[model samples]
Target: MAATAPKSLGAGEGAGNIGFDRSGIAGESKGLLKVLDTARKVAKSDSSVLITGESGTGKELIARAIHRNSTRRNGPMVIINCGAIPSELLESELFGHEKGAFTGAHRSRTGRFEIADNGSLFLDEIGDMSSDLQVKLLRAIQERKFERVGGTQTIAVDIRVISATNKDLAAAIKEGEFREDLYYRLNVIPIHILPLRERRDDIFPLTDYFQNNLLDRSTDYQIKQFSDQAKQVLTHYEWPGNIRELENMVERISVLVEEVDIQVHDLPECMITPSSHHTSSSVSSVFNNGIGFNEAVDQYQRSLISHALNESGWVKARAAEMLKMNRTTLVEKLKKMHIKPEMETPIF
Candidate 1:
């Protein structure tokens, strides 16, 4: 466990950082700090924990932190992404399978539960688990014992479970997609990580750290700095993809931009400008002119796209980000609207 979290979101202060230095979780916002505090407090206990957050918020990092700080630190910290494994094969993966358990069961293999005995199990994207598997999982957690597939002997595991999800489990329960009883069992201690936009203060510090380390390790590049304008633009932009997006952008800039200082143009258009959905006086002009509702909406979209292109140095890829749109979707819109060659030089 980290002795203390950095007081500021500067280059290298990690407060209560237990297991995330190698995983790239950098932030000092109140929201992030509070979550770390909660993680620290809960790590001392053996109860199941549920971490909820948007994609790319580093839920797995928190799970590892808990495990590292817990009494089971020396034991194996087994991890399984519930959403990544196929539903048909998930059962065998969780509980060991005996030889001839199924068509492809060539040999008896130990499963995650058995491997995680006397340790911790990190289950990511728990919400995506199918209802059928939910019942078996519930029994395993409640009873702390499960039989291997096609095997009569029961396996007992003394493991701590930490689960993460991007989905709203309550809504899933209300709709009968997830079981209510399972939800209660998994959500013993909850940690909700705020998205990057909500904790915008961490952007610059995270970028600084990611850029320095990413460049220093790269054979093709050297460390680079961000211009003040570039930093401001990044700070103002809403990072829909959160820390993962920011780290990726930093790595891209370090490798792609030759300059020692990263300029505004070096960033992806999405990070330099507000999403097109924000309030804009330029878009309001159509309505001020008393134009038809449909026509006004159409004009607004075109104008926004055009402005995004201009701001993005006529780069369609960056423009699409500035517009908060998929590149293919933007291309289709441009084709339908007849965006002129003079306005946008089409580049595949």
Candidate 2:
């Protein structure tokens, strides 16, 4: 069974202020509701917001909602994937430069910040930013001013900064990988996203949504429904890639399976049998005749933890639900197992 919604939602009116229509999103889980609520409340304010979650958890959608709801909705909303750009050219990409600033500088170019004037700038995968660039970003946020690479004049921007990351920034700060001051500055209001596995109640709804909304029209395949057994299999199996994986699986089944209802046989091969679900079991049964009971238990635990972590994109709270444990207990288990809650590489 899926867990309850985050406790933050019931504490005050602010928790209940998520303005977006929950019915429109993929799933009907409490996690989805809470995220929408948090996004709504944060949207009303212009303060910097740092959205943290595993990849494919729809961080960009939340950012877009915030931008659309904010006072700057009429203006443009520029998105810059910090991890996608080369380190050498990031500075120029953020702050425009005059002609001849670099080898390929043919004309005066505008950066994301300048183009996003009177709007919002969304910096995705911000954890991958270099330390030197972090200093420049801090300066810009602190002073609301920045200068192009080769320009003499200072440009003042009236824009809101919204950043998202999939790394454990706190741990990064401890290791001196991320700057402490910069972290605090961007984390003015932090929003955490729950992964899909934690909210099993929303699985059927999400599957239906994908079938109705994302399926290709040209394909002659009719709408498919999940059988009760298939639903149980989905709920029990670990979702490593969160919603994106689920969406992909659904689309794949839609294309390959001819029937209107999806059964256990329609699932991917790895998920069909209980023994094939874990790496150790498949190895042990074939090579060692049978594995030790304790080793099997450990493998099971590891599989559960890994699945939950992947489904929730490594967010601890959501992973905890996927494991059917309390958040604090899950954190303790992670520590004991030496499993880091956050992904090492940036996942935005």
Tens-digit lDDT track of model 1 for 103-207: 999999899999999999888999999999999999999888999999999889899989999999999999999999999999999999988767776787787
Which one is best on TM-score? 1
RMSD of each: 10.2, 13.5
Provide the clash count, candidate 2.
2
> In model 2, how large is the Cα lDDT of residue 253?
93
For 65-99, candidate 2 gives per-residue lDDT tens digits of: 78887888899999999999997899999998899
lDDT of 1: 0.77
What is the Cα-based lDDT of residue 336 in candidate 2?
74
Tell me the spans in candidate 2 whose CA falls farther than 4 Å from its real position. Answer: 1-24, 218-221, 273-348
